[model samples]
Target: MSRAIRSAPSAAAPTFAALALAAGAVVAVLLGVYGSVHQPTGRTLTTLGFSSLISMKVWLAVVAGMLALAQAATAAWMYGLVGGSKSAPRFVGPLHRATGALAVLVTLPVAFSCLWSLGFQSYDTRVVVHSVVGCLLYGALVTKVLVLHGRPTPGWLLPAAGGAVLTALVLVVMTSAVWYLGTQGVPTSTGY
Candidate 1:
């Protein structure tokens, strides 16, 4: 490859990472806002005074749980960009960035809803775990943002971020599986 052409991938990298960080930031901020607002009092689900189609729990879960899932896909998409064990194609780079960014975008609503759900006084032990992990994951995402800002995007960072995100997802999904299965489960989130 010529020197001029070789520079293209590197130049393109910062843009991709910036997009990922921006999307992630939006997701995290929205979630943080929602987490701070949710305060369910009675077991009954209430309306948000919007269209008649939405319920509070449904809206919140969709936002929080879905955001978590979207972030997971973002991690994989990042890995796809990084293309460990194989050199990532030029086309794949954009795809990776796009997917990662999209995942974060899709997650924004869920994140806020999650935060909103926590506002409710009636809480479960599982929720506490979810909250802590959510914070840690968000913190990791912030680190990812800083990393992107400080350096050009590298292939390895994708997997690292993905691994962090996947770990969080594991905790979120299989909270009680461990004790039930006679093994230690992942720790719960504390809304950090």
Candidate 2:
């Protein structure tokens, strides 16, 4: 009988995941620093026939939140957390990708507008919370993407990163869009 030997698992995967997470943290910190130091342009954007820039941002954030919710659902389905099946349906993967892409697309304009016009305001508690979490949202997103693309990562890493992204996104939406809707109500008219 021959003796069997098993090699130790490679350490590179965890190291890569750590490095990616660190890079994401750096990106987030840089964004926050830039937002803090740079003077706001106070310039507002008009788009999609919104009555005001704030209204536009509010709506866009709402859209992004909805898309994020869809992303979460699809992710759960893919992982078989929601569905009873051992394997996800093929459509779930595409739907997840599509919703994730759409969420990013819908969020970009709002993020640009915020950084350009607001520049990480800190006058009020809500503003401060919103500004900080806004930066974290991007950071979490970066980490999630990096972990996803970097193969051989720890099985738990991707889900952890994704959960962080989702949490940050929910906070951002709650602090901004939900607050706006509560105080100002929905915009009835569009610029178009």
Query: Which candidate number maximizes TM-score?
Result: 2
Whole-model lDDT values for every prediction: 0.48, 0.81
Q: Which digits, one per residue and each the tens of the lDDT, describe model 1 over residues 82-133?
A: 3453344455445545655654554444344445433422266876676656
At residue 107, candidate 1 shows an lDDT of: 40
Q: Which pairs clash in model 2? A: 49-190, 49-191, 49-192, 50-191
**Runs with alpha carbons beyond 4 Å of true place in candidate 1:** 1-85, 120-122, 152-158, 173-192
Q: How much is 180 displaced in model 2, in angstroms?
A: 0.6
**Model 1 — which ten-residue stretch has the worst lDDT?**
183-192
User: Model 2, 29-147: lDDT tens per residue?
Assistant: 98899899989988776555677777788899999999989988988877767868757777887888899989888888888888888798999999998999989889988988887
